[model samples]
Target chain A: MSKQIKGREIHLKSRPQGEPTPGNFELVEVTVPEPAEGQLLVRNLFMSVDPYMRGRMNDVKSYVPPFKLGEALDGGAVGQVVRSRAPGFQEGDFVTSSGGWREYHVADARQYMKVDPNVGSLSAYLGVLGMPGMTAYVGLLDLGKPVAGETVFVSGAAGAVGGLVGQIAKIQGCRVVGSAGSPEKVKHLREDLGFDDAFNYKDGPVADALARTCPEGIDVYFDNVGGEHLEASIGKMKNYGRIVLCGAISQYNATAPTPGPRNLTLAVGKRLTLQGFIVSDQRHQHRRPDFLRDVGGWLREKKVKEVETVVEGLDKAPEAFIGLLRGHNTGKMVVKLASGPA
Target chain B: MSKQIKGREIHLKSRPQGEPTPGNFELVEVTVPEPAEGQLLVRNLFMSVDPYMRGRMNDVKSYVPPFKLGEALDGGAVGQVVRSRAPGFQEGDFVTSSGGWREYHVADARQYMKVDPNVGSLSAYLGVLGMPGMTAYVGLLDLGKPVAGETVFVSGAAGAVGGLVGQIAKIQGCRVVGSAGSPEKVKHLREDLGFDDAFNYKDGPVADALARTCPEGIDVYFDNVGGEHLEASIGKMKNYGRIVLCGAISQYNATAPTPGPRNLTLAVGKRLTLQGFIVSDQRHQHRRPDFLRDVGGWLREKKVKEVETVVEGLDKAPEAFIGLLRGHNTGKMVVKLASGPA
Candidate 1:
């Protein structure tokens, strides 16, 4: 006999014009169906609310499809496989999947990746030991190619991926400088994250701050916030610099098309290379094991830290996401689901 | 005893605020110095007037030094050795040197490169076989990296470097499309240059023209004209496309800071790469012999054609340069100096 469970889920009520609002989301109670032939039912413990989620609220053909209107929103989440009909899975297995924005999910067993809690905490699997961690590893090492003694300038350095990028750069023996929206985040980047230098972009012009903080021009720039920050980075880049275009959280919510960096002409004279990427691309996915080995070791050694801002419930995911876009959270923002037995 | 010679040279009367004018130049007659112990005297045959020269007039730190006021301007030119005091050089040898905007030059023998007249025309040494040709060869092959059956889009395709880029892309088995300023240049690009499609950008919006011309979207974009054209190219680029930033003739004369492509955010989802270079960089210069072998063979086999707008007399050099910036000439713009014995 199958046991029916009632769970809370968040759906996209409507699409936002620019910046999202809580009204655009709806939380409702739903019946969790029994696991079909090759499927399993999951009890989500923690779900991610990220800056990239803002793009999904708009109707456009992107690397990932837009969130469907009037349906449950989905993203990275850690859950317990409470029921299983698939051969490779069993009841009470800890797993991670794109079954977020909900308390319980019913999906194919293939959708979930089994995580060993002995390796790290459940929330760490969503933050440092997960997608954001992998993004930092692939972006800084594979793309940025930072070598020892090279200076790396990271924007949004207090955020999930940016924070890890600075720490990883330090591990690579690089001189790391970062910019964040607030003084507190800047302080956190310097004091907690171990960035060589940090600045509040809101305090003064990014160009002036960059010049002052990074006396020698940047050899690599990790761009998480685009627009004026990107322009300023280009101005401060040394010859043959590499720019990793990881995210443009600053322009994601703009109602109009934002103008790019005007000083791109400098790229010609300086022979710079600017490249963009999506973390899920197969080329990057191949590096996941190596990412785990390196970042996992660092975490265990306490050389790298995992920072998170936890919201109380699934009903608060929309506000958390909106806050993420507004730079409200200092690091990875996650919504905590019901605290229950595994 | 050394023979004295009177020669005419062009001097920078003043730096221009925006678009350069003929008033900024002054042509003067001066005595050509006799060959020193290790120097040589040469009579100039032809000189190059390129879009890059505009940057040197702005009095800013760049890849090349700015043109000093009230001094003879120097650039790429082919000349005949009239007198020599160095062992390697002989009288009547054709050489290429930075002796442009003058009738004669006196410099150390090491400052010139001996060019074989049998390989190409004396003027060709200043155009197809010289700096412009090397730029297209290195930028397209190294940076763009077009594979067979890919589509390559080129802006300012009727100009010196761009024209070679389209032809070289075709040589690499790519479908080539181009954009030019005038209808006549468009016709020349399609009918004479063997481009698959060509559009006059002045006809309408660059976005509409690009969408219509690049039906399958672009795999490679050789950007010679920046601003709107660059913006349009980014909109039409396929996933993992490459953009080679060569020149920005469109923005060189802008009195104010020109805004960049507004769609750079698309680069992230599409995984685009935008790289810029200078041909004179030692790394690119290392490819010179390979460039000559391939492009020189193409020239001999008639697979590639070198187009030039020949401006007669050194007096017309200033006007020709101004016109070069305004898109008044198709292909390479070069000034033919006095016609004399080699």
Candidate 2:
């Protein structure tokens, strides 16, 4: 017999023209969904706020579908499996899934991955041990193809993906440099993240900063914030350099057509390759085990440090998400719905 | 013994402000001397006038060196080895080398490749079997990676590199479409070169032309004239489409920065990979045999057609070279030296 329970849900009220305001989101009380055949009912502990979500907020066709108005927005989340009707999942197990911005979600059990609590914190699975970590690993290693002694430049260095990218590049014996928005974030990148150098992008011209840090030229550039950062990286790229376009947080909320570097002619002169990627396209299932093992080892060894802005209560998620867009959060931005055992 | 021979040489008198004028070139009488210890005396037969040479005429740093004023402008050419002190070359041997705008010159034997008459015409080596042919083969196959049944769009369809790219893409079982400046070139692309469809780019807006021809979004865009054509291709490209940037002939002589498509944001939305390449970087000695064999077979089977505007005499070389920049020539534009046998 299915049990009915009350759940807190956040729905899209309206599409934002530029920067999303509170009016765009609606918090509502709803009956928790019951698991159908081969489904699992989960109680979410933490929800992820990502830059890529901005693309979904707009009514535009992209790699992923746009978020519908008056519907619950869905993304990566860590939860406890309260009930299960599938072979793989059982009650009381910790898991992660593309669950809605809700206290409880009923999803196909196959979509939810069981997490090992002994390895790390359950929230860490939503950030470093999850999709964001895999995105950084495959995008840089497979596409960027960093060789030893190469200079790797990463934008949004303090974010979940960028922060891990710098650390991974360092493990590969690359001279890793990064750019973040604030001095505090830059300090974290240099001190804790093991970046060879870090710069505050807001301080001065990015090209000048790149010149000072990367005297030779950048061999690979992992672009998280596009527009001017892409232009600056283009100017300072070595011959045959590869640019991994992970995200463009800089232009996500731009009301007008974003003004970008018009000097794409440099791509020809420099013999550069600029590739845009969606993490889902990378075939995560086959790679997930290896990724978990590798990144898990790095975390345990303290080679890769992770920082998170843990927003308490699901009610504060929209503000935390907005804060992420404004570069106010360091590392992974995750909203906590419950007080943990600690 | 050092012997002197009379030859006609064209010198860069001044750099052109916009479109290079005939006044910029000064034809002068020069003494062609004998080969040094490791050099060969080559009697230039047919010289190529390619778009990439335009970049070398300017003082700006490029893949190759800038053209020096009062010195003979150099480009790829088919010639006959008259004398050789180097072990690799011999007298009366047909070869391809970077022969300057001159009747006869002493070249390093190491710099020239011996052309086989059994493969194709000696002049074909200057266009189809040499740099331009390799450019199409490597750039399209390596960068574009056209799969069977994919739609491929090419700009500058009648030019040396573009013409070959369309045919090569077709050979790979791709549905190939191209854009040319004239009706004759358009006809050549469709009727002679085996392109699935072709259009006159000068007739109307490229986006409109692309929309009409490419109902299925472009899988690969081989860009030779990158201005409006590049922008149009960007709009038509499918998800994960590959853009092989071979050259930007349209923007070479641009006085002001050519205002490119402001909608480069489409790159992220479509997840396009835009790459630029120079053929020399990908070339290795081992690849030449296979390249010549495959491209040579296509030439002999008449699956591919080679066309050229053979301007008579070295004195006409500068005019032909300038004509190439203005899109005055069809296919490969070549200057025939008076001192060589036809």
Candidate 3:
């Protein structure tokens, strides 16, 4: 026990008032705890920062429980097992687990899934081959159900989950249109990601951009940013269009009740289906095999590209998360707690 | 041809800018043209006026085509066949057909269904046994999918489709709650229609009314009046709730677009499904046999009660339709075009 080291963690210092600020997070030091029977101790290499975490900072009830003040905030992270007291796991093996925002976490052997470096990069396990990837996979294929000739529209198109959605739709032989916050992000969508069309929503009204891009109307909409983006997509939706309500980053910071899309009534006349979902609810569907098999092959073949905004140091997670909410990141935003194995 | 009589019809005089006025309709006398070969001439006994007609009054695109200016509005009607050139239909037979804003209509014999008056009343064919009835059946059973003991909330609960929705839900063993415009409508929903609870939304905020009525939360919400009713229903929805988007009469008359339910983002966390459909889409899924057998049995056994607000004369149809949009009627609003044979 005396040979154990010390580690640091980011805690939820205080709940935010509208939008979060630096004051909401606290960094504290703690002794690295030993792995119990059937548990393993791991050193986190990378931890994800996402828009959904913003909801957890609030004291209200939500799909995920609120982050408690004075306690470490937990989320998705990739780590290497340093010590094992469990079956089928050994030292130096990389695994993905939740309860991250910390340098070290003692997890039950089954809490993390062992990752294969031969399959993909270690960090890719936290982004493309992980939760975000699965979300895009299930939400698009199961709910959006885009056909080969259909036109699909996605808000937050250059984002973690959304980027994969657009790419998957393209692979499925659909024409894709994307909306992003910056011109560079838009360029990434078109020139890099091969979207049929892309628009910078910040430059103009979303409805106008959608009209110009989706002249034939949208058959499916993958919604990550809500509010105006959602409304515009609905306005341009064709008969029997499908909307996958995955996230709504646009309304997360709203102090007052945000207005919903005005044109939702179009659903009735168009016979549209708007389905809202949380990725965790569908985890039992065992879509990981398809995600890794398809996405891993695409990664190796360079058919799919991974975009990331990496902020160095564990202390930088708060800034990365806040930046993500502001659409400052072009893709998956992660805080690097430690460097890769030398 | 010698016994043929003249009939007057109401035409769409002009597209209404906002709310429809009497000037929007033009009543004119037209000669009773003789039925051609394989056609039937019928004297309309009763005709229906529904909220969806308001959309037709506009010159914009919708699920149904816009009513052409100077052309008679067409909708559900029941009549007695006066003459027939077809084999199936006979003189004095009762039938139901579309294209009914006139006192008498000439139609291909196949265009109308020869309806038996033994199952239900002739007017019930225009409401509880006709299009509105089918809408209630499909939207609730097919989309809403309520289970036994679940709480189902219905808006515009005393209206034609909504009334049948509550009764059908009750028969399915659900705890039904309803909201209506008037105290009398609410009383009828509770005392006569057997709703578990009822509220007059005209008396207070819809959110408060829903909270009071649905203390345990709503499982299935059949949305009729879209604005606040839809918003309030979303707030009280349970996990995996299903919302049947039936109508949005509250927003139909607005010159500008109406705001959707702001809390719709709750769908992500609650995993709610909000599906909008036109009754016509599910028509091929003919529920007619089930409707006639079950609803007829309910009517005969006195488990269900039917209500109608009758306006005498086809000349008064414009007012009847206008009043329906204003929530001026309880249950089905029908216009008496003529009386049947003595």
Query: Which residue pairs show collisions in model 2?
Result: none
The positional error of residue B97 in candidate 1, measured at the CA in angstroms, is 1.2
Clashing pairs in 3: none
- Per-prediction TM-score, please? 0.98, 0.96, 0.97
Lowest summed lDDT over 10 consecutive residues: which window, candidate 1 chain B? B333-342
In order of DockQ, best first, we have: 1, 3, 2
**Ranking by TM-score, best first?**
1, 3, 2
Give the lDDT of residue A92 in candidate 1. 85
Candidate 3 C-alpha lDDT tens digits along B1-342: 566577899999999888899999999999888898899998899999999999988888898899999988999999998888889888999999996899888989889998889978899999988888888988999899999999999999999999999999999999999999998899999998999999999898999998898999999999998999999999999999999999999999999988878898999999899999988775435777887788888989887777889999999999999999999999999999888842
Which of candidates 1 and 2 reaches a greater lDDT? 1
Q: Give the TM-score of candidate 3.
A: 0.97
Poorest 10 consecutive residues of model 2 chain B by lDDT? B282-291
Query: Can you tell me which runs of candidate 1 are displaced by over 4 Å?
Result: A340-342
Give the poorly placed runs of model 3, Cα more than 4 Å off. A282-284, A340-342, B282-284
| CA lDDT of each prediction against the hidden true structure | 0.92, 0.87, 0.90
- lDDT tens digits, residues B1-342, model 2? 455687888899998888889999999998887688999888888888888878888888877889999899888888888888999777888888887587787877788888886777777887888888888888898789999999999999899889999999999999999999999989989988989999999999999999999998899999998888988898889998999988899998987766555566677668889998878875434566777888989989988888777888878887898889888888888887744542
Q: Give the fraction of true interface contacts kept by model 3.
A: 0.94
Name the lDDT value of residue A244 in candidate 3. 95
